[model samples]
Target: MTKLNLLLVIALLGSALVLVRTSYEGRRLFAALDRAKNEQRQLDIDYKRLDAERQAQATHLRVEQVAREKLQMRTATPAVTQYVGDRPHAASGVAR
Candidate 1:
């Protein structure tokens, strides 16, 4: 009877230790998951902000402004326009 009781007590202690260790590991994993979720949220916000900035930079007005200011480009006008063809008089429809 004494030996049986001692063996049962040892088994119970071992099971209790395992349960405590598992619980501690679970809490640690939960904390890591929370930190990862926060990081993901921050990354998502940054991506959205960058996408908005990209859209603003790609706008037509912004492109034209950059072209005119930085590239020294100008809009085409009739006075500056030129026409070309295979023959000199091909566009005017006059026989050579």
Candidate 2:
């Protein structure tokens, strides 16, 4: 009877240990999941911000402003344009 009591006590202690370890692992898993969710949320916000910035940069007015101010570029005037040919020339005999 004493040996049976001892065996019962050992089994109960082992079960308690298993329960504690399981609870610890559960809390750790929940913490990791929460951290991942927070990171995902932050990434989503960053992605939206970057997307908005890209849209602003891709606007025609913004592009033109950057080109004029940063690149010092200008549009060609009609007077500066040289038209080479108004009439079609006869094709030379160089066809395959």
Candidate 3:
């Protein structure tokens, strides 16, 4: 009967240790998941902010402003326009 009691105590201690280890693992996994979710939320917010900035930058007025200011571009006018008369190509005898 004493040997049986010792065996039972050993089994009970092993079970308690397994339970504790699994509970600790569960808490660790839950904390990792929470951190991942917070990171995802922050990334989503940053993406939205960058998307808004991109939209603002891609507006027609912004494009025109950049073109004129940075590229020194201007609207075409007849005074500055040049036209070339088509001549027959020597290789294909074509005017296109």
Candidate 4:
């Protein structure tokens, strides 16, 4: 009977240790999950802000502004335009 009681106590201690370890692991995992969720929220906010900025940059006015300012570009006007016409070939003298 004494041996049986000792065995039961040993089993109970082992199970208690396992329970404590499982509970601790569960809490650690929960904290990690919470941190991951917070990080996801921050990433989502950043993505939305960047998307809005991209949309703003893609506007027609913004594109034209960047083009003219950065590229020193201007709209085509007839005064500044040139046209070329096909002429006869040098050797064959034909406008094929």
Candidate 5:
């Protein structure tokens, strides 16, 4: 009878150990999943911010401002422009 009791106690202890390990692994998995969700949320926020910045930079007015301010460029005036090179000229009197 004492031997049977000892065997039963050992079996119960083994079952308890298995249960504890399973519970621990489940909790760890849940924690990792939570962390991943938080990271995804943060990345979404960063993407939105970058999209807004891109939109602002791509505006027509912003492009013109950058061109004028950074490159110091301006449109051509008719008084300062001239047309040339419309008609072809004959070659000089030299053999080919």
Candidate 6:
């Protein structure tokens, strides 16, 4: 009877230790998951901000401003327009 009681106590202690270890690990994993979710939210915000910046940079007015200021480009005007003649072969609709 004493031997049986001793065995039962040992089994209970082992089970308690296992439970404690599992609980700790579960809390650690939960904390990690929370941190990952926060990181994901921050990344999402960054992506949205960058996308807005990209859209602003790609606007037509912005493009024209950059072209005129940096590249010295100008819009086409009727006074400066020139007409070109098509190739003779193209006009005849035959391959050369």
Q: What is the C-alpha lDDT of each candidate?
A: 0.96, 0.96, 0.98, 0.97, 0.95, 0.96
Please provide, for model 2 over 1-96, each residue's C-alpha lDDT reduced to its tens digit, 9 standing for 90 to 100: 999999999999999999999999999999999999999999999999999999988999999999999999888899778888678867999886
Candidates in order, TM-scores: namely 0.78, 0.78, 0.85, 0.87, 0.74, 0.80
lDDT (C-alpha) at residue 1 in model 3: 100
Candidate 4 local accuracy as lDDT? Answer: 0.97
Q: How does candidate 3 score on lDDT? A: 0.98
Give lDDT tens digits, candidate 6, residues 1-96.
999999999999999999999999999999999999999999999999999999999999999999999999999999888989876753666667
Looking at model 2, residue 70 earns an lDDT score of 97
Comparison by lDDT, 3 against 6, better one: 3
The worst-scoring run of ten residues by lDDT in candidate 6 lies at 87-96
Error of 3 at 17 (Å): 0.6
- At residue 50, what lDDT does model 6 achieve? 100
For lDDT, candidate 4 versus 6, the one ahead is 4
Pick the winner on TM-score between candidates 5 and 6: 6
Candidate 1 achieves a global lDDT of 0.96
Best by TM-score: 4
Error (Å) of candidate 1 at residue 62 is 0.6
Q: Candidate 4, residue 22: CA error in Å?
A: 0.4
* lDDT, residue 9, model 2: 100
Predicted candidate 3 versus true structure: per-residue lDDT over 8-82, tens digit per residue: 999999999999999999999999999999999999999999999999999999999999999999989999999
lDDT of 5 by residue, 1-96 (tens): 999999999999999999999999999999999999999999999999999999999999999999999999776899777878668768889888
